[model samples]
Target: MVKFRNAAAAFKALNGLICVYKPACVPIQQIQHTILTNLCRDLNVLPDRPHEKRVEIVGPTNAPMTVKLVPNYADNPLVCGPRYIKEDFRCSWATHLGLFTSGVLLLGINQGTKLTYLINTARLTRAYKIHGQLGKATDTYFWNGKTVEKSTYGHVTREKIDKVVAHMQAAHQKTMFEMSGVHMESQTMFDLAAQGLIRPANNNLPVIYGIKCVYFNSPNITLEIQAINEYDKYLWTIIHDLGVQLKTSAHCTGVQCIRQGKFDLDIALLRKHWQLEYIIDNMDQCRRLMEEHSLILQPKSAILSV
Candidate 1:
């Protein structure tokens, strides 16, 4: 479940940014919608016009346009008429995860929304723990896809899997050929289920940092992968090319932003500073709080400049 902390005052004073832990089976857009809806409801945000019952006639209109207002404090709007309040406050993750995948999703809220471009290009590295089965190939080049090839793994051993991981981790920039349809380009990686035939002419290097087979017990294998790219398909393609027959589709079990930098997401550190009351309606106080919690990156400042 996506959790939302009240950062309205802090956001207005300092900058708005949020760290969301998106679980599997939930869309990123859905998480965004939930946050927006919850924040709106909590802040008592009303329609644009709360006081006016109707809009005055304009040049094209012959009669006044009646406005429908649902009073937040009204118990029976139809019987008691409309009621209005004067409280005014307003507040508003781009690293997309698949519906079946779960991981850390960074979001920029309110003024923080302006930092999307900078954060997206900040070269943040991500770590993922993926689980999948071995000994079969799916038609879609991933275990989640329909089964296309099946083979006996009686001869496959843990040693073989380790070698494959080492091969992938030690692979040089020149040896790694990008597979088409696995995210980019159009060359096929495994047309006839042969690894030798997968020679995609793409000359670009893979953005993968390293891959390690964490555990290999029979049909299930856990892989700890570190990559700079956004697409998880590339990891699947690399695993396939390394000769691991994927029986089950891979699911990211754990994700962490490891690199210590401006864009690295360390939510635990940020949560402590989410004290909205401390920075409530005070820009100077917010700046002081920000300085005190210097771990909160200054990307929000860069966003404000834009």
Candidate 2:
């Protein structure tokens, strides 16, 4: 789901700094200034001329980490800023400031993954005018909504930096990864606006959207792969239904070892999505993932996918 992409944990930490410190106006410029000047600096070194250089919050794969900029105010499109700093801002910064910072990170993206899937699935259900044109997963809702207090947070993570004082980590097993083939009813949106129908700005068209890395701490790539595979098949089924001629395939790589093991997964993914190239890269996150496994020496990246 789009919710859990927390491309980079920048927005989460930004929320923490805003709320805890209780800044003046809660204005965008003011918030940005506060985040850049105060919170970011205290956690890790701030980049010089941050506004000058393109600050992109990314994952291990260099993909834009989608973090929700939780509003101190304003709720138009329910917009959230993506890619403000490098990915895992929580892992990096939360190590210093503690749980509240971590919560900020989770609430934005990782935690939102489940809800995103739920809401989208619900939307597709009502919008399911075209039968057999979408994946079955889109029809199924995982939110048995029976709320238990235990279901409140995303996975707990640790900020294990190896440094004695920097050993805090967020156990991220709480987030859920999902694959959805919801036929987004955005044709009306596409029909409007300036640009012609070359590409839909809303991307409300039928898409086989898959959410990987929702639970970044999950050790098993096989499970995530299974989710992706299902999404891919769903896409294929839809393509077949529409009688569109398009070849399909799959590719992935990452540190393929354990934190206590020797090999690391160093891989990437790029595939033909109805002739359009779509990629989910955690090259950097993959690097960090490999780093942990590399504590055993012979880092995986050194061997492959560097």
Candidate 3:
């Protein structure tokens, strides 16, 4: 573990990766903004005004003191230079989850920002435990998408779902394929669905390299899906087109990161951290694999090294 003397030192020492668990109803950018705000407060890196004075409560025996808490950077040139001060850390995210989809978000700090490209491009797998119903069709291709046709299917069987899933798993390779009458075009699926195409010819299909069915109830399913390409609409498309109704929104339960060759991260971190986990495994490997590797890091002397 890394240690530092003060908040400033700790801030400067914070140069690694971390995962932040995001719950439903919170946007990814909001999470990032919150983290940065808290970190700034912790580091005491807010801009200081020389003329500003704050009231201070003193001990019982002493009088209350009016103190200028922070030194003015304009007067002191050293304070403005490469010291324990920074506007913000270079930040990046590996992947994204929906506003209503709770999942693990990979966060990169400082030098760790260099790792996001590899993590994003790598063939990582995500596990989703979705609570959904079968036999309803929505025009938007998602259960929540403006219910075009409610109560579409009366009853669904495990055998039928298994067959559909098997078909999807096999259909992963097919670039141009149609499930029923819908086309699986990569970019235009959402648009096509939005246009209210009833039993359309063909649309976009995001690539699904593999899918493992963990468990299947009539209206609920737990799946571990692997995809070479990523689009938020892809998973919903598969479920909706398969003629399943969504009882509740789906959420990502776990993610497996495959970097370089083998498994690089432990999935248990999601539960432990509640949604996010910082990953450091194969950092060098990722940096090496990136096409443009430029890390803008402050000098070590700017932070307390002890």
Candidate 4:
């Protein structure tokens, strides 16, 4: 768990909740701040937290898992509207952090054929070390029953986006943003995030434009969450089985790449202090890894230093 020493820093907190599956509540003060702080550092991004709330979920087996909800105000939702009808527009979480991946579903993007929003199987929460405090990541950035800055205008139709544009103009006091199509030529998590239906936040209130802070909004959108409720059960069973086998003994081992190898790293320290794995990839990443392990990191690339 990370601690935000400065108690005054701000972060996203809309449909946010700290879920505790059991009767006991998790000591969220540190973990919450840690998630936020580490995420910020990795992506070099910053965000503000709003009001705080906690939710409790109980498992039939009496086990509990606290899923904290935190908001993340995105300047980009991976899609721009109006004039961007020709090109691809997108707002991807992993790309900003420079994560190497594929088959991503962005929160929003223009597919040329259609505009989709996918709240899929992926982690959608980020915390930061604001002003030096390690904040925990509250990851409820999904379109689940969580709250959001939305309006109940119509069903999931083209008109739905039209009203959102109007509200955004009035809310932000300008046409501050837009969406179009997407970039890159692979399946990515960024685009999968924007394939969902948008309805009015409320049914009785016709004028109640649902506008909840997107960050810390509700259910943290992640790849795992997507498969649970939306995708086919059979598909998930097969995929999960396959995924588990591929993760371990993967390409990270130095045996496969030769240039990259497992290090006798102070693994606990990496997880504890930096929230990162200390896999010795190259001389650059392993400089600190070697120093910590009292070992020297040699270059797999034998290019002589000119």
Better structure of 1 and 2 per lDDT: 1
In candidate 1, where is summed lDDT lowest over 10 consecutive residues? 297-306
lDDT string for model 2 (1-306, tens) is: 112223233334232111112111232233224334333333333222122223344456566575443324222222433223334333111101111111111111233234233322322211001111111122211112222222111222222112211211111111111111222245533332223112112323332222122222321111111111122223223322221111111112111111111111122221111010111122233335435644224311100010
Q: In model 2, what is the error at residue 256, expressed in angstroms? A: 29
TM-score of 4: 0.15
Query: CA lDDT of each candidate?
Result: 0.48, 0.22, 0.48, 0.22
- Tens digits of per-residue lDDT for model 4 on 168-199? 33543111111112223335323422333122
RMSD of 4: 29.1
Off by over 4 Å in 2: 1-114, 117-231, 238-306
Error of 3 at 276 (Å): 14
Say which prediction, candidate 3 or candidate 4, comes out ahead on TM-score: 3
Could you tell me which 10 consecutive residues in candidate 4 have the lowest summed lDDT? 250-259
| Native-referenced Cα lDDT, model 1 | 0.48
lDDT of 1 by residue, 192-253 (tens): 22332222232223355568888878666677776554465655565466554322323222
Candidate 2 lDDT score at position 3: 24
